[model samples]
Target: MHIPDGLLSMPMIIITYAITIMGIVYSLRKLKNFPEDKIPLLGLFAAGVFAAQMVNFPIIGGVSGHLLGATLVAILLGPYAAILVMTAVLIIQTLLFGDGGITAMGANILNMGIVGASLGYATYSKLKDMNEVIAIGFASWLSVVVGATLTAIEIGLSKSLPFMKVLTLMIGYHVIIGIGEAILTLFIIKAVKTKLPEIGGVPA
Candidate 1:
């Protein structure tokens, strides 16, 4: 849900930029404490997530959806690192490819990078002790929904469309998209756990 330039009001843009900068700063501070050995995984995960986002599938009413992968990255690398990964991905998408608008990049990062990754990690951390797969699946699904909801609100605040209608449509399409996110997240986590066996000791 990348918002293009001119879609958001000036006030909203400024506010989002302020919030996103704070998140990035905080995330970078926390990232400094991450183990050195796990650093390489961040690049790999970011590359995979960037590649995954390129393939967008059609949803109802010609809307398109793709894997956000925030929950998956958060589960694998931790939430702080996930934010950095997502921020890097979004920056490249906006600058080089123009996949998302330059002016709206702040909102995009805040929605997917901060909100999606942070909430997903929190959810997974809370439920993982009880059931790993179920926790991952639910966290992946819910994070997408939450991101979509935030995007809908931002779009609605612009007054360019009806708030409730946009909210309903965004959430409706994202729910279907969330299933794919959940499945992919679970598969990747399971694969990593099987191969490495020592990394996080992900429960089967």
Candidate 2:
């Protein structure tokens, strides 16, 4: 979900920016040991996510939800790299497409990049040994829901909208969109595992 400008209060904006900046710094540090060869794959994932986010469907207020692809990227790359990749995508969208607002960019990155990647990666890693398909599907779905939830909380806390109403509506819409995310993630992961099995060591 992309939050536009003028929706969040000044305090919330500053807080989110502070948190997001810390996350970015930490992720960059982790990338210090990242495989240099994976750079292309990272770029590929970032580009794909950037393109996918182009098609957005409006939700209540100035928010809109779309195929985030954060979970999928997290699965292919590590969580740290996934965060960076999502950061790149979000920054590009904010600067080039204005898909998300400049002032609200921090919140967008916090919700979709940090939360989405970390949650998805944790969910998938825990369940993968049990059932790969289920893990991917559930992780993909959960990422979207959790990110939307965070967005709801941020917006609601800003007092721009009633906390319960926005939370309910955001969760409801994201639940449906998350299914699409799950299916797309499953399809892509499966295809990559079949065709380019060596790409990410994605389990078959």
Candidate 3:
């Protein structure tokens, strides 16, 4: 889902950069207000997310998929912190590993960090009270779908590809990927609740 440079048009790139900058700035302010003791946990979660993204599995038609870990991080560290964490991960991947494009960094951050984490967090928060497992699962799945949809739209708007074709292809493969995300998220949440107990106040 990491768009390479030259994939997005100038206008889309600028728009994404503007939105991403605002999200980063707001998240930094919110981070300053977070409890000091929880700072290390943020690092831990970031590291975990970074590591998880290292392994990409083949999907279909020669495409591949990897864990975004956006929803998972949001579940553990709220949307603001999750944004910061994802930003760091993406920067490292782009600059150090060349996984994502340097020019398209802002767009990637906007799609995965802002859209994925924020919407996923909101979804989980609203549904958790009803059923924790279901909430995490649903949020994890829905977040990926939403991100893919946005990516498709961006590509479509560029006039480089057919709108519905790109949309269908992206969403079709990601639907399976979303199931993996949901399962991984649920397992991790369950593990944290059983072992850490203090993290995220996961219900017993």
Query: Residues 1-204, candidate 1, lDDT per residue (tens digit)?
Result: 788887888888898889999999998988877887877878888999999899887767777788887778888888888889999999999999997788889999988888877899999999989998899999999998999899889878977777889999889989988888888889988998898675673221
Taking the candidates one at a time, how many backbone clashes does each contain?
Answer: 0, 0, 0
Please list the residue runs of candidate 1 whose C-alpha ends up more than 4 Å from where it truly belongs after superposition. 59-62, 201-204
Ordered list by TM-score, greatest first:
3, 1, 2
TM value for model 3 = 0.94
Question: Candidate 2: deviation at residue 148, Å?
Answer: 0.7
Q: Kindly report which residue pairs in candidate 2 clash with one another.
A: none
- lDDT string, candidate 2, 1-204, tens digits: 789997898999999999999999998998888888888988988998887777776655665657888789888878888889989988888998887789999999988888878889899999999999999999999998999898898889887557898999889989888888888889988886788767856321
Q: Residue 202 of model 1: what lDDT?
A: 26
Q: What is the Cα-based lDDT of residue 135 in candidate 3? A: 94
lDDT of 3 by residue, 54-124 (tens): 88777668877788888888888778888999999999999999976787898888877788788998899
User: RMSDs, each prediction?
Assistant: 2.4, 3.0, 2.3
Q: Candidate 3, residue 53: CA error in Å?
A: 0.5
Q: What's model 3's overall lDDT?
A: 0.85
lDDT per prediction? 0.86, 0.86, 0.85
Candidate 3 root-mean-square deviation in Å = 2.3
